[model samples]
Target chain A: MGGLQAGSVGAFKGRDVISILDFTRSDLEELFEAADWFRRRLLDGNVPKLLDGRLVALAFFEPSTRTRLSFEAAAKRLGGETIGFTSEEAISVAKGESFADTIRMLDAYADIIVVRHKYEGAALYAAEVAEKPVVNAGDGRQHHPTQAMIDLYTVKLLFGSPDGLVYAVLGDLRYSRAAISFLYGLTLYKPKRVYLVSPPQLRIREEVEMVLRERGLPYREASDITEVIEEVDVLYVVRIQRERFPDPMEYEKVRGSYRVTPELVKKGKPTLRILHPLPKVDEIDPRVDSMPQAAYFFQASLGVPLRMALLTMILGVYAG
Target chain B: MGPVPDSELLVRKIREGTVIDHIPAGRALAVLRILGITGREGFRVAVVMNVESRKLGRKDIVKVEGRLLKPHEVDVIALIAPTATINIVKDYKVVEKRRVKIPRLVEGVLKCKNPTCITRKKGEYIRSRFRLVSEKPVILQCVYCGTLLHEDEILAQVLGEQE
Candidate 1:
């Protein structure tokens, strides 16, 4: 929290939130502080008009509900207007318009752009071609920086600090952008250790392992989720999407391999909390939702203030 | 191999071209592949692989007798053969000599290995872009996908021919 007090808002003005690796420990702390400020203001029934005339463009070439709507709501609550499309069907892209041209056209209309694309590097490509700042909502299996930010904020709020905590990321490690982003965000804090639990076919990607090695952070990979459930402080879960597999039989083999049942939750540490970047199909049992350790809904709600803080910082309009 | 001979003796002097020397043995072909230097007509190319060297225990040298390499081509060579040196020969004398250094940014030369990477999509005109992250391990991260690629992947995914 000391880093938050020492940060200046001008540092992030006009910056592109392309990847979590682009941020440092202090940058994340500063964002969390800003989010806390916004949250308090909302509780007091005051909507800050810091971005009264700004325009945010949401260009989602992929389907999304939580990330797209949260970002739109964040911009609107900040007293800014928004204009953009939710799907490729709603845009000129269906007519064979190039990605660069779409970004260029959006750049001319909006102050900032938020993009989510099915292609891995689409957001970075858009950021390269556009004049306006681009925020990557979710880009293929690569990154979702804002989702990472909200996740970090959620964990920090729950534990009072993210330091000295053990995190276990379970299921679909290779294809989950949220898991990658969350791991990158966790590197900012001095965590106890990170355990990657998944089927070997869906184990953590080498790119993420390289980051952990470079940071000198201790991590272990295990095929069984139950092996680390009792030891870790947080269990970050991601869905195993059948669409990501080339063969339907391959997806069927691992479909229910890592489900978090009430029985499994009972064996976890009393202080353990569970989280998922949701729209989940059947990864978590419905019975676990009523438990005190279920934090996915709260985690989803944190997106509003976290994204508002991000927009405010990137736009350089946050007064406090 | 009784005694190591000078590289100049292995490949004849080039009047006006480029000499890629000090390449690790067995990697001359990879360097050629990366530079897109096929054994095509209208170019005099000499490739001496597994040659003895004092600096490198065993090395390869490629002497092109008619043309100097472009700067970007030199960068590609550096990625493949970090120890290789580029020598521009003019009028049968080495005029310019320098070791290859990895460029900060590489564009259109290599494709991202991720199948879902936008640069690989059929209709999209996205060029493959990578930022050189580590030279020793020859690591490059795709600017778009954020996927880290190593030397093996680089060799495999690099565009076969300029388009």
Candidate 2:
């Protein structure tokens, strides 16, 4: 499954990595291997402490819960010290320091910067001006490469491999950057089928469809989650990002197109695992959380290993 | 070639000035609306419209005698007509023949990005700073609301705002 993506990035020298698409199959494979290696060392109690003196700085211009804590956890586990803002309310950024200058200032102090900003391409902009390495924790509604990495890693861990798998991605395809990056990342593989379940107004973008065409990955969409739930090997759910939408009234119109519950899974396949890049509002009912096939927790758990792999690869902390 | 056809652009040269050539047709007014051109008496101005250009289908040129367009004005013009070239003419010899470069931090080229932020749907001053994120792909960031503006959409929107 990992081919040119593995190698095009010859020896990772801590470059400015902003998107998962920048990585080849070879690069992903290397990342996965390095992360799995780190995961093994911690579990075995002979941890090598490869990045003891390294410092990772996080600058988040928006509110975050899981992403902020999870990225900090990933960096700390790598034997690196971390410092940053979970929210922008207290920073000098609130007093009108432009993003470029802030990034430039951080470049002198920190070895790597993991930033989440509200504006699209802000991560790319930070990566552009900074001489040190920068990673996109998530940027606006544009890309979430690390989260997509965790999602794919969870699929691999669960099913052994991602080859010839059919998955149903439900809810808010248009405004959900997670869904967009997930679908974009998945399309790089030859998935058997991808059922994009969203309302009529929130279909996967044509730009997304064009990338699917480029990779020759097959896909289709439906308004009903029930229509394709039985056929999928996995059911990936995403919340409609109401905050990303400028108008609240538009969000009201498309809120209930798909709702997952234990009742919805009554006769569902035992092997059909459900995944959500979460902070889920009502899309996945709480009753569904206790079910045997609920993999969102496990999905979230995969973030550590995946990001450990990602950080090591990008920073060259691992034995090459 | 033959006395530079029509030659209505016969304003006297200055020791130092900028000549903006090949602006798209019907945009001379917008360019003139830029600072120091409309009511200021010192800077001599030359406006030529309906000129021939295979690239623009039609063109206009504004030559400012004894002055030059500011960095802000160049950013404004680059938003409208990327092909419009700015020449720094000193003593009738040309230098710096290229399209105006949009600055990374822009002021006075646009308004707020929010629909409800009192700029999109109203007549209030559509003024804001912008940051250039990508040059080839051309994404602009609004300073007020931090929205990334798709390149041509805002350019077209500003065209409507001018009228």
Candidate 3:
């Protein structure tokens, strides 16, 4: 309440959540405060049905667990209904239905759309086709705006704010849309430093790197996580996706190159928070889950309230 | 005139078409492409490449016989050849001449090389739109995907058909 505009109604009403870059530091700060408000409400067992009588279409052309379900849960928790498909076979897309036509169909039914697809610009395309706002759950290996929102919100909850936190983004920097989006989100705030930890072949994409350089964001590239492990306040890890690799041999080469273990966490600061966009494969050690430094489960839990805030704000129902 | 330059002699003067002068050397073919003159448009096109210029060390020139250049075509020419001057030929005389200026937004002229760009979708028919980000190296960002296209990529897209 002290941070953002006071009592401004529907600042983000019907706006498309296509890219993390679309929001400024101030916008995100306002959103975090809203998320905190929702968190408190949920904790008090007083859920506000801000999105009552609303419809959300979940158009997931690619396979997903967290993103799809979290958006669905977010809508329902706000007294909103969810529609749309999880796979192509569940819809007309399997029958050679065009992406535009399918989106148009959803637009007629839903008040808003949350899209996840294997193609990079699919969500942007959907936003173009639909009159309703489109939220990008994940798109190709480039963008996952809402996941970045939850990640940043978690960091804010744990460490006061994401500002001035030395972060080491570990694992797949090139092929993970969640990782890419998180990096983009960091540019909205002032970070002390960001250490990009990835294998040589999986370094951050050239365009993403260019954006960081343009923003004058201080960052360093390290092939191994241990290089900056001791210095970072946060170690954000992501799975090295085999499905993203165009070449099977290339995937084999980088497979298991980076893994977060209890031993690795020991190298970091005592107060270090480890985060991952879940449904991870072998990249993280299960034994490390019980460690005090592990914040991924808590991070995942924050997704619900964060998304609930997002839904209400997008629908112009966030009176706060 | 001080013994007409050999480059000028290469292509005879056109009676009722536009003459594009000072295209960057070796890019006359690309200029022709942006104009959609594929040598099959039934218009006689004379391309002169590696022509010596005092301003530009070397240049290419494209002369199309009987068609006036469109504004969009001029916009694209500015992208590849910023210093280019367009001369309108009418009744066997130069009627109008102007230097090309790069437009801020280019739409439906060049295909975005980003295969995943919304404009590149098979059945969407979304017109490719690009914003001019940098002028020196000629960088363009796809309005849909935010993918950057450097000079090489921009050239390749301009040369491809405008489908």
Candidate 4:
């Protein structure tokens, strides 16, 4: 209530969530506050029909689990109807329709569009073609703006602030869209430092590095996670995606190079929190789940309210 | 006198066309490719490479007779040769002389090298777009994929067909 006034929601109305860089610190704060309000409302059993009579078109051209379902749940919970395809096969895309045409078609039916595609910048392209607000759920290894919001929300809930936190992004930095999104989200905050922990081949991409340099943010790279695990406040882990690697042999070498086991978690700071953009493969050990540091499940659950906040705000329905 | 200086003899003066001067050593070919100049009849082109220059130790010059580049075409030249200058020659005189500056946004001139870039996907009408992020190294960030393309990558990935 103190953060997202009706005027704050106005800033998000009809905005396209293509890149986390598009949002400033104040904008993200408003979103986090809005998401918090929704979470509280859900807990109190007060389901606001903020998005009632609206329709959400989810165009997931690639495979998705949490992102697609969470958006659907968020829309439905707000009393809005959901439409669109979860895969290319479910839609006319299988018939070889252009992406622009598909987006234009979806724009006609839905008040807003959430797109997830395997190609980087697909959401930006869709936003160009669509008239309605376009929310990027995920776009290849480029960005996942909504996931960044959820991740930021989870971190904010745990730390009470986004300032001065030392974050260690562990694992495949080059290929993970979640990591890229998270890094972009961190730019909005005054993070002390971001340690890029990955193999030589999988170091953070130059585009992200350029953004960091432009912002004058401090960051360092290390081959091993243990070097920075104890010093960081949050450990954001990402899986080494096999499909992203063109060479199978290179993927084999770095596949399981870094794993978050109980022992690794013990090396982390007392307040260290582990978060992964779910459907994680072998990056995080199951034994570490019972620990207080495992915030991924809660993080995953936060997606509902986070996306709800995004959807309603973009649709200009959130009166808060 | 005896023979024009080697530098002066490199590229013949254009009566009425565009002269791209001070192109870094050997990038005239890239300029031609970007400008869609194929040296076909009716369009006379002279490309002089590795010519001595006081400012650029070595330079390349392209003189296209009877052709004036569009604004976007000049942008492509700016990307390829940041130090190059564009001169519009008309009636045997340099009518307009201006240095090429890389535009903030480049659209459809180059292709995003990332195979998974939306612009690269088939059946998608998304035009390849890029934002000029860094000028020192001449870095281009694909507006769609957020991938930073360097100079070498730009040359190789520029679309063959100019729209």
- When 2 and 4 are scored with lDDT, the better candidate is 4
Model 4 preserves the real interface contacts to a fraction of 1.00
Q: What number of clashing residue pairs does each candidate have, in the order they appear? A: 1, 9, 0, 1
TM-scores for chain A, candidates in order?
Answer: 0.95, 0.93, 0.96, 0.95
What lDDT is reached at residue B109 by model 2? 55
CA lDDT of A78 in candidate 1?
Answer: 83
Q: Per-residue lDDT for B23-111 in model 1, tens only?
A: 88878877877777898846899989887878888999988888888777687777767889998989998898998899999877787
Task: Write one digit per residue (lDDT tens) for candidate 1, span A118-167.
Answer: 88878877887887789998888889899899888899999999899999
Sliding window of 10 residues with minimal summed lDDT for model 1 chain A: A1-10
> How far is A203's C-alpha from truth in model 1 (Å)?
0.8
Worst 10 residues of 1 chain B by lDDT: B154-163
Name the runs in model 3 displaced over 4 angstroms: A1-10, B1-17, B24-26, B38-59, B65-67, B78-83, B89-96, B156-163
Q: Identify the leading candidate in terms of lDDT.
A: 3
Candidate 4, residues B55-159: lDDT per residue as tens digits?
A: 999998988888887656686778768899998989989989999988889887787778888888987766788888878878888887888889767755553
The CAPRI category of model 3 is medium
Model 4 chain A: ten consecutive residues of lowest lDDT: A1-10
Query: With candidate 2 superimposed using the best TM-score fit, by how many Å does residue B124's alpha carbon deviate from the native?
Result: 23
Say which prediction, candidate 2 or candidate 4, comes out ahead on TM-score: 4
- What DockQ was computed for model 3? 0.59
lDDT of each: 0.85, 0.73, 0.86, 0.85
For TM-score, the strongest prediction is: 3
